[model samples]
Target chain A: MVNKSISEINNRIKDGSVNVVTAEEMVGIVAELGAQGAAREVDVVTTGTFGAMCSSGVFLNFGHAEPPIKMQKVWLNDVEAYTGVAAVDAYIGATQVSETLGMEYGGAHVIEDLIRGNTIDVHAISPGTDCYPRKILDTTLDINDLNQAIMLNPRNAYQKYNAATNSTSQKLYTYMGSLMPNYGNVTYSGAGVLSPLSNDPEYRTIGTGTRIFLGGTQGYIVGQGTQHSSKSGFGTLMLQGDLKEMDAEFVRASTFTGYGVSLYVGMGIPIPILDEKVALATAVSDADIITQVMDYGIPTRDRPVVRGVTYEELRSGSIEIKGREVTTSSLSSFKRSRQIAGILKDWISHGEFFLSQPAERLPSDTVSKPMKQTRGTAMVRDIMAKDVMTIHKNASVFDAAKMIMDVSFNHLPVVTENNILVGIITAWDISKAVAQNTFDLVENIMTRKVITATDTEQVTIAARRLEQHGVSAMPVVDEQHHVIGIITSDDISMLFARRN
Target chain B: MKIRIIINRDIVTKPILAEAIIETGIPLNIAQAHFDSTTGEIIADIEDTEYRMIKNALVSRGAEVLRLDTPINWDEEECVECGGCISVCPTKVFSMDEEWNLKVDTTKCIQCGTCIEMCPHDALSLDV
Candidate 1:
């Protein structure tokens, strides 16, 4: 076995003889050759993961449109893309839900479309200026037309991620994947010790400016990831790079049905065997990385802690949560992770890629508040029911009654043709009318004047309205006078459930 | 261009691929393949002109040519473009344009169909 230096590895990389193995494969080498022998023989260990990373996005300069508008408003396929930058530049966030499709589509889909080299419909309405006269430019877009497409993510590759489950009776649609009610299922995001940042707990060789395989392209670590808690069970890092180098497949957009848009970031890291210590770091397996399984149904940053459990427990297909052994599945792919590790290993061995020394070490001094709760940013919009079951003006009285009994809901907002909140009927009102045998047209029994709330209103406003009206639920309207959602008492109760 | 074909359970014992080559003059390049008594899904490439000939030959040999609406099922309605499929895509069929819209190239696709596993949207799937 030879103790190959970085220079020697680079030299071998040039000559196409660099000895590389995936972190999965390296475990076997150490078992056969021993840690010291394997450390001397191997130059690099590649690690990877493909999972839903919400903190991912792209910055694109669309160049100048014909008679360019200083586009204030931007939408890619009806999903809002941020136009806060210069006129031609837009930052397409991965989580921005489509105006048309709502949470079903978003900016992550926009990024995927761009990478696929498909034409994107770029529609922008601007408050026109003399310098930039166009008020609206409806145009088709091709990725090549952009001046710059930067993949600048504030966070990715969580060192250790939580396995989320539900304790409450209601199912939670979250970025944590779908948390079934009554602990029916758990969705764990961590690749366990196979997780990139978790393997390098101290961030020795993997750090800022480190070349990494990101979304099928070479990307670098830019800075500290948000909520980067080194004090927590694992170390996290933030990264950025050019989107141009990536394929459309690696950086994908996904909508978790009701949960909204999220990006599946494909990432790979090369751990150079600097010494036996470094080799040992790569040896850390699923059994070593202890992570938490939080109750997503608990609804707060400081969600109800189920218990600390190892990734081995996580991967066992079920976890013991609050004395109940609940089943668990992965949002992150095990197959893709192994595939990425293999790809990196081949790239190093065939001299197609070379590892570079990170320009800076990952900062250890960074403060990550364990209580960094995002409760302050919680808006009425986030909690509002986007899809409310409404009784159509023409629907029969039995149907309305059944809707209430089926869901045990108190209020039913009656909607007109354009989804206008025409009137509201309560289960209490229905019982009174039915006792009187006045079960004819709903308008005859339903309240003609309905107190309503708009989707843009604050939680305080909705809460105030509910108190003032002494109502269990209020219809939430949008600008088009559409009944977009209903603010129910049960929905408001969720705020308090997570407050502790 | 590449297309996928399913094998009948009865034909699981038959060398259908070999028969396809013998019966049809066209050459088939199997990029990705999976076979079992329950199912035989193969993604194979052939010249455009040979599509009908290959279909007829395979059909005669107890094979079902899976006619896809588009073998690459990309639903723009649900796609979030998070790039889960990019890393595992063997053909690089999926990518993002300048506008960040996920675009698909059926031409480059060998129809490996790995995107179905990684899509959080449940938006992508091959007809096969």
Candidate 2:
């Protein structure tokens, strides 16, 4: 049963004599008890993760005909490779498949398939949709003199939807240019070339006239434009722009594929670890319960030993039983001897020998002994204190202080009308609230959450709760939200001291 | 004279009694018993030659004999056919039966709870 009063359990626990058994110990105890005529009622307690993972692994291993898409191998081709559009489409398609399958979503795979494809007209293709085409020159152009230029003109840059896929397409242009110049081995001429007028319409003046020619200008300019074209053409006519369209499709598909693969492998593994932790926690709890039951005593039947001689044998002065010789000559007082003989007679009559003392007892003063100490089987109601103080959600600060002073408690439980524990109003909390004047109502000043303990819990558990919450006191309550007792730090200290 | 008493089992009041005897300063006779050994039986029967000294030593040590003489019998037929009691018994008084039921190798059963709890037929009982 859940201990409602945290303080009381904590007190017993602090005394250092509470029985806290782990799972392995419980198993031994259960076996021992079963041997001693008691039925084992071992119940396994755990969080859900262990079972979940076992189920998941089983399902993954056996449920599917083929390996799940997450583990499936996908391949990408050249057009999909160049613009990376194919990867993106594959990613989106995989997401759709995952949603349709009702299985946990895993990502897609993107493999860069480098295949040979011909370069097409740049003006007809879409940006980021068509693969970037290369212009392979048969001969290297003069590095100093070549001026390369590219121009693109598209009918539209923004088209929301097309009948082909009902997906929007955004067009954009990018321009890149570079220049290289070479100037070397120059000679200046001044005589005939600079002559004043010999059949030349223009003649150079005589004073230091010189002519010079400069060479070598090399650069390239790149530009692009996109037009929004809805595929209204049918059959053969549609084949006209298939190359550019396919290039665009590959770019989108490639992007989706890469994204899908990443989501499946990288993000899915950690999600299941949380479930594993839950299972571990449950196993530990079961072990603890088993240990507790085993430590309790097991019952056994009686075995009686007898040592006696009949009256006739005594009179004859000779007796023997089980190959042991009997000597009865030391009887100084006949009556006393008869009394001793009579006691032996009784043991023999019952067909059992009774040993007057216990054969073995555990050492009373050892650490292990204390650890195995059992708290009597008393329910929480047996130890719970009924006098409890509670505060409402909207109570005022003054009202809270008055309640605290009246009850002489360091902390007060604050519950809603429905009896749920919404918060706690400790003296420290109240003092802070009052000092700041930041909140007018108790709800504003009160701690919105508080750790609680049940009535049926052991004092050891209560002490642990206290330590875990780092609180000096906690309120004990029943199922119906009624406060039963208040356990304090001092109570735990006294309980621990007394137990020692 | 100083004397030491070695008990075969963990006795609760032995140390207190020992201290009391030491303060009295009486001639002591020491008897030692191996409690933690395989056979946890007390071998307190000192030889007649050393009886006087042993008696004096026990008195000096404040060793009170709680039980001096008691007749113990083992019922062979009533013995349950289980061997668990043998394991926990300090004195090796009981042994297992090779042929029939749980036979008491009276030489081995120290009468510990091990066998008593182990017997499923409710057979083994202690004559205390």
Candidate 3:
């Protein structure tokens, strides 16, 4: 039995303020009051998770200075910042490592420093210009000094992340955290009932533009996360939020020792108990949310799933794998997750927080690509460079030349101020410009008409297109036509290697 | 019949191996030796009975001994050098070199399985 419309809840929320219950309390409510009664009483169920996600990053719009350089190259406290957006605006990626400190310090650290009200060493070098004269500038910048600081993450809070274990006889260092040898210890990321997407299960309420509590402030989901998948029944989303409102405690950077850097983002999503189903989904216990155990020792796209286990068994500190008791730990801190959820619950119960209908629903049909398959065809995403290093159209010739020389990459995906794929510049293009003494601006020399491949399209099709166009690489766009990745001839050669 | 021994300054400054051989009248060969100011480690080959006799003599002389089947080998392809083995190893067997790379002292390792359990990647094992 279900009875409660979203409008009725919103109307009550508007002025007729009603009481609220937490995701944890809702568990007790349904057990006692039943789903119908619980749904009628609690307007919304607050869910949260604080986890390390490398795909997370902060976008900063630095207000133009007296003599602002295009800022072709930018670094904050020695950590490289992607200045491929607007002239002054930059994006600090969580995984982007520091030049001097290596992987020990990264963009995530810079964001944390900014949030902590600490001034960071800002360094930028640009070729001399007429309109924008400042070429070399070194200064200190705090988060408050920036015009806008927004948290726009590509992926966060994986709904059913795998539990990590090592199957090989030796120990391996991976981004999944330190896995003890021979299934010595297991580590899982999902916080079960405390996870936001786990509570939703279905994307009925939490979707695009759904307002959420992000790091102690209000934020909304912009669109689907890069690896949005449910195939097993759930909705995952990439989220965006204003950085100026977030708390420093909830937004921090962590270097995973041997692994790369990741951001510890605190997110609280409210699930409106519109019906009994929503209430039931919100009541899911740790035992209900099942995830697979994966052995990273066998390094392959098709990493073997040792077995399926639940958060309950994982949180218990040990699980049986291959008839041996292996110690279990968590990569995502559940204590932090519960703390965030408790904060959200307090806000909702106090009528300080309100739930908003999603501006747009996240597509539930987005399926994850299967790992094992007979060799025949492969998607562009399978071979494309997902972590692409891009060059802004406004970048200087010197900057472009330096980048091309540094990485020794031929093709540079030229992005506009809005991060939209405009065109590309090749080594030949740069060489030709340099030979003629015309390599001044990327926007001036970059080819505007760009040939691109969609993520889902077959690699063979992309290969044929590349051959027809006589290009070495092609940009891979998503359904939204955003340049998500780049496919190169080197990546496609693997398709041939698969034959042997 | 092959083993490695870690000796303190008291045993290190003395010709302990030669003394042990002469005392036991056991035919032994010193395969390799590494010595420093206060400590030393030596690899030697002998008969099984003689090896045990040497072990007793070394321990009696305040020397730490480790039996070895073969030298321990590192699988480089499988190792990312996380340095998990350095702490668990009691003999200071596994250490990070100047470049922070996991370096194994074959002579010092006792095959205690502590490092094997500590290593997340299965990279170290006795070659034998």
Candidate 4:
């Protein structure tokens, strides 16, 4: 039941008597001392993670142009920056590719170059207005020339994430790195027990305004990150820091083979062990934290989970999948992560850093949901043509061929006297009729077993039916078997075009 | 000393390496090898003193041999030691020490270029 406030810990740190340890060290300390004893002895536990985070970006305030142009479009070193905000203020996303260099260079590269004190080419355009009347401006500037450069990541440290493996025969190039064909390898990204969010799984001390170490400089947790799902054990953190104070060694740019560029960020957080529960939470080991291994080969919103595995198993360099042993690799840097944690621990022990109580706690029960799609709801009646060309069974083959040739139609429905669909004929069928010398009637060459589409069927289902039956068109019918209309692959494609 | 030998299609099916080993009477440790219908590549480690003898024997057998003095270059300054090369390297060239520090054993590298291609920092290269 030992309890301590952040202010008390700060006072102790100021007195040069505070005890702090890294999350990795704290695991052994807690195991030896137990949670209650550890809470009484330890003051803080620092956690860290260094991994590729694509949702990270920096916002820059480039002061103002000579004539004060409202930058509608902007590019830094040929990489585009989002100018949808205020004038002269732009956000460069990490994954945005370069117009000239493509994926070989990107916004992440520009950020890295700026951090390294390299000059960057700044290009901008504006639809000139009276208040801000500059048409185009191109200039070179470095990190020192900017008014403000802030790194505001929407999502940075994931608490834990699924491991990725490919099940397909061909190699897969993805944000997960290059997955070898036929499960040749497995790639996982996380700092495991050293991760910040994993130490504060319930977000007890990690929330809005919580101080953190961002890329070698002190930063703050802005809020719960995008897609933060603590219920499923994949919590994330949104962060903000001053890019000017960051070290180039802690921030890097990476280009995934077929995927675009992403920023590899080094981040750390100091968890104040206020109570026994907090101490126990920080004691979580790799074996205690479990995550699923997903098959990235499916390429769907819901990739199939191959199996549940612990971080200890993933870190062992190999794991069993479907009765086959597969080698595992890591995209996140554990060495760098340990270094970050150690640095933070030293800062706190020297009283150079102090933790802050969160203004608000993050949600612990939320789950990330898939995007709701509207395209699959379209019915066959919405895209089918009502004016269907039909031929009677008693009609001559020449008449059927004439109707199909005149409209450039590939298929024609053969119906009875009451206009009920009984068979279907194609231009190929007429050509066969000529080759076989059977030019008497349409029924002689028509396919009697017609694959028909109901008016109420979904457009996607109708398209699948067309593919399954190997037909170009299908006659839409009513409950009474009346040929109401026709659906073709072209019509479905046009509908897709319109929707897109 | 480690060397990589490439046997062409004309003599790929023949036992050139075994014949060379017998002729030189030098124990050769075959670390890795890959064979296709057109060609075959074999990487083996042998004693440094017998390097010339094996080279002559392999050359006499019409097999192209190259000394793997520097198969890959690691830029420690740029590398964050992400372990992205551990699984892709067929020979387990990269590993984590007990302290979780990255350790690289270039002796096991087959020069397959998989690690160089997969490195996010562009730290690993075959330029050497």
- For residues A1-500, write the lDDT of model 1, one tens digit per residue: 34556677788889876788888777778878778988888888899987888888889888786786898998889988788888888888899988888876788888888888888888899999989998998888778878888988888888878777788776556676556678877767756656888767778787777888888988888867887777664556687877877875567777775567888888989888888777878887888888887877654457877788887887665677667767666677666677778788888888888788887788765657655555575566778787678888777677788999987768888988888878988888889878988776666678877777776666776786688678778888877778888888778888868776
Scored by lDDT, the top model is: 4
When candidate 1 is compared with the true two-chain complex, its DockQ is: 0.07
Q: Rank the candidates by DockQ, best first.
A: 4, 1, 3, 2
TM-score of chain B of each: 0.74, 0.41, 0.53, 0.83
- Weakest ten-residue segment in model 1 chain B by summed lDDT: B79-88
**Candidate 3 C-alpha lDDT tens digits along A1-500:** 66677677767766747666667777888888887888777778888887677888888887876787888888889988888886888888988998998976788888878887889888888885887788888888788889999989988877778878898666656676667577766767766877888888778887888888887788888878886877655456788888877876677676665677878788888888888888888887888888899988765576899999988897665689999877665656565677778887777666677777887877778787766766567778777888776789899978888888987878888887667887788888888899999959988899888888888787877897788678889888766657788899888897779766
Candidate 4 deviation (Cα RMSD): 9.6
Best by DockQ: 4
Sort by lDDT, top down from the best: 4, 1, 3, 2
Q: Which stretches of candidate 1 lie over 4 Å from their true place?
A: A1-4, A322-324, A370-500, B1-119, B123-128
B1-128 per-residue lDDT for model 2 (tens digits) = 11224443344336633554465444333333434543232334333355454555554554433222232254443332223233233344443333312335543333333334323223456665
TM-score, one value per model: 0.64, 0.22, 0.63, 0.78
**Candidate 2 TM-score over all chains jointly:** 0.22
Whole-model alpha-carbon lDDT for candidate 3: 0.76
lDDT of each: 0.77, 0.30, 0.76, 0.91
Best by TM-score: 4
lDDT string, candidate 2, A213-242, tens digits: 000011011111122122211000000011
Alpha-carbon deviation at A463 in model 3, angstroms:
26
- Model 3, runs deviating above 4 Å: A11-17, A370-500, B1-128
Global Cα lDDT for candidate 2: 0.30
